[model samples]
Target: MKFTATQTGKFSGPGFTARCVLGKGGVVKASQKREGDGASPAGTWPVRNVFFRPDRLDPPVTSLPLVPLKPYDGWCDAPDHRLYNRPVSLPFSASHEKLWRDDHVYDVIVELGYNDDPVTPGLGSAIFMHLARPNFEPTEGCIALEQNDLLTLLELMVPGAEIEISF
Candidate 1:
């Protein structure tokens, strides 16, 4: 199955569509995507895996691989680091994002296959589809959707499903 998230803030797949929020800087071509630029890379990226906070919610039901998030989970975003664009344990010295966030937004994270292949330094990192804030605020670089909508979509996604993010 294939899903799509557009610049107009619509996320659709199979037979359902829901509002979504993109990066603050909007969407850009994958090649033009830069670290910390606040723009979501525009392209079709595979759904790598799903990570959810077990303390906050029960494991989500989906065909995709799922992992319960650990408090020590983190994603290295420092371009200069060897582990850039990869998951790491906490206390990581390099600049990174704490996957175990205090905010509800990261409670349900859909890891997207962005900047992980060969991981070009500074291209981008930690791009995911996660729960949106109450007001549907823009994300740093990931896509955001309401909790219920995201959960519903996850149930319909298949193993090889990919999300096409476009302008």
Candidate 2:
């Protein structure tokens, strides 16, 4: 099943509808995506994989490939680097986003296939579906959900599942 999201924070799947928090800058066309724009790219993104903080919770129930987030796991966002938009080690020389966060947000992370295939420079990167704040605050450029709601979406998602976002 595909997960569809609206600007109003209602994220719905085939058999479920869960509230979600979108990017702080709101949703925009894929062409409008930029490095640090804080807008969620509007498009259909496949579920690439999942990364969870195993030390915090059990593995989520899902068919998509799952990997435990390492303390050194990070995503390089430095456009000039070859590893840009790819996972990197901590203490990385280039600009990167830490995956092993101290907060609960990265505890359950679902990689959204966004600007990763070719990893174009200046495009957005590190987009994901992750745990939302108690007040459902806006995200950097990801779809945020409550822990339980995220788990539910995970359980419902299958291999090749994609998320379609619109304004």
Candidate 3:
């Protein structure tokens, strides 16, 4: 329902309507698994929780709701580990692991549900709602936008904010 890094050209079909999902920030740099870089990931990811600017309190954390950080809260993207398709804790060492790091980027994440598949690692890992670049380009398998826009949407989002991406 929200867009961050939108392309300048005329987008057709699903991208033609205002209702169809759109991306705005970090678009130029977006990447899929094969392109090596500059491609947006494709899949439906469930909004896990919401994070807000600790200073601003007027807008209120409405959409999706906010869940406090927990010690065990994590999403697994490690292809080699046994917990490859599940959540794991810290102090873990692996070859293809992508645990939620302690950075502001992962602060507001929407846990993708596709990677849970038993057959594959479910594409890449660490997809989230991060701040967009100043130019508003593509992202690295994650949706992005200006910090202000993100906060505004967060305030208005519903409990089950779903991000469905299709090619």
Candidate maximizing lDDT: 1
| Tens digit per residue, CA lDDT, model 1, 1-167 | 89999989999989999999999999999999999999999999999999999999999999999999999999999999999999999999999999998899999999999988878999999999999999998999899999999999999998999999999
Best by TM-score: 1
Please write out the lDDT profile of model 3 over residues 1-167, one tens digit for every residue: 43222343222222222211234322332233422243455554566656433433333456565644444456555665677655566556653323244445444444444344432543455556555555645555566545655565565556655555555
Compute each candidate's TM-score over C-alphas. Answer: 0.99, 0.98, 0.57
Better model by lDDT, 2 or 3? 2
> Every model's Cα RMSD, please?
0.6, 0.8, 6.3
Instruction: Give the 10-residue window scoring lowest on summed lDDT in candidate 2.
Output: 1-10
Clashes of each: 0, 0, 18
Name the lDDT value of residue 37 in candidate 2.
Answer: 90
Candidate 1's TM-score reads 0.99
Candidate 2 is scored at a TM of 0.98
For model 1, give the 10-residue run with minimal summed lDDT: 113-122
lDDT of every predicted structure (CA atoms): 0.95, 0.91, 0.47
Error of 2 at 71 (Å): 0.7
Off by over 4 Å in 2: none
